[model samples]
Target chain A: MTSQDLFAEISIQAEDFSLADEVALLEKDNLTDGAVVTFTGRVRNNNNGNSVTSLTLEHYPGMTEKSLAKIINQAKEQWQIGRVKVIHRIGELHIGEQIVFVGVTSKHRQDAFAANEFIMDYLKVKAPFWKKEQITEAGKTSENWLDAKTGDTDKAELWS
Target chain B: MIKIVFFAALREQLDCAELSLSADDVKTVNEVKQRLSDRNSQWRQTFSNASLLSAVNHDMVAGDHLVKSGDEVAFFPPVTGG
Candidate 1:
């Protein structure tokens, strides 16, 4: 099947990704797209002023990918999306690294915007991911793993 | 017997995930909660005065629903995961 006809969700062990490549895949075959919007969540080196050294992401194996695909399908059914690309990283990653990326393309700005927001909201609350941040201060390291916040649920409920 | 599980914050608060009790002990979901809360002060504090959620067979369920053996029952704070 054409990539655009199906949603793509993957957990990879490679060194990040090329947004250019991902966006290209959305527009790969034929030509019917008018607007393309993408959201990339990066691993910043600081959180509330703490110098983050590394981050570790964990997720439930088969279930995680299934949940993500379901979310993308829901978004596709809602909006006239041409293609959607969702890539999330698992395992340990350093600061200034890429954590997750979502790319959506549609024939109109409204479809692109709605689908992009829908994918992000579902990923935040439903995709079964946990992040542990390792912070460094004065050459000492401490790891702090925080649970998913309540604000994310509120954000997802807006579309529900 | 049915096994009830708690996850994330609820598990942290209850200090446990899976609990085993006889079919006769808990017929309704509410009865399960009451039995759990009666175990200790910790459970009472975690379940008695809180907005707890439950799942039967991994799907969300109400408090008064009946539970069957081998069913996976889960309790948690209103799901905050995404």
Candidate 2:
């Protein structure tokens, strides 16, 4: 395996992640990187005028990791990147909790920024994780499966 | 037998997690889906959803993809995680 491949990591877990710790680890042993970029997605309290109390994420066990790895590998091929880390939290997550993270390190700001965004966009549309939000409307709480946004699909297709 | 699995909302709607069905006559993913939906009205409703997504052995594919005796097929709604 190439040394660059060793710097990449992907985590799919039920526990929350520390952004600072993740970034530090991504930056570890970096000698040529001049830029690092990271993105985090959080659980919001509301969606489409409903009060979202929490989100429960479910995924196809083996497929989720394979799909995520495919996205990261795509990014690696598209950019001259050094390090990549992707962490996505599953199970129940409350409002204001972090849900996903994508971090990339590269020698140039353009590569780092573009690769990070590229990974996030593709991950949104391609990953096998499904989020079910507990939304309250008129004092009735119901679990609603979020529909894929056309805008998100468009954004991901932009990379193609 | 071919193993079939459901995830997320589709699993809840179908009231099934996983099941094994004889693969004797089913040759494609679409055929398996057609047989599953024939179980009852609830199963029919969920599988007939136009937006349902599916995978064969962890790789996403269309309804016409062929299946084998031991192949695992999964069905679900569109992915929403970022």
Chain A TM per candidate, in order of listing: 0.90, 0.95
Window of ten residues with lowest summed lDDT in model 1 chain B: B73-82
Q: Model 2: which residue pairs collide?
A: none
Superposition TM-score, candidate 2 onto the true structure: 0.95
Q: Point to the candidate with the largest lDDT.
A: 2
Model 1 CAPRI quality = incorrect
Model 1: residue B68 alpha-carbon error in angstroms: 3.3
lDDT of 1 by residue, A44-137 (tens): 8787789988887765445467767888889878998887788888778887778788888888999999999888898887765667778899
Q: Which candidate number would show the highest TM-score if scored against the true structure?
A: 2
Q: What is the DockQ for all candidates, taken in turn?
A: 0.22, 0.85
Quote model 1's TM-score: 0.71
**Residue A69 Cα positional deviation in candidate 1, in Å, after optimal superposition:** 3.4
Tens-place lDDT digits, model 2, residues B1-82: 9999998888888788999989998999999999998999988887889988889999999999999999999988888997
Q: What are the lDDT figures for the candidates, one per model?
A: 0.75, 0.90
Candidate 2 displacement at residue A58 in angstroms: 1.1
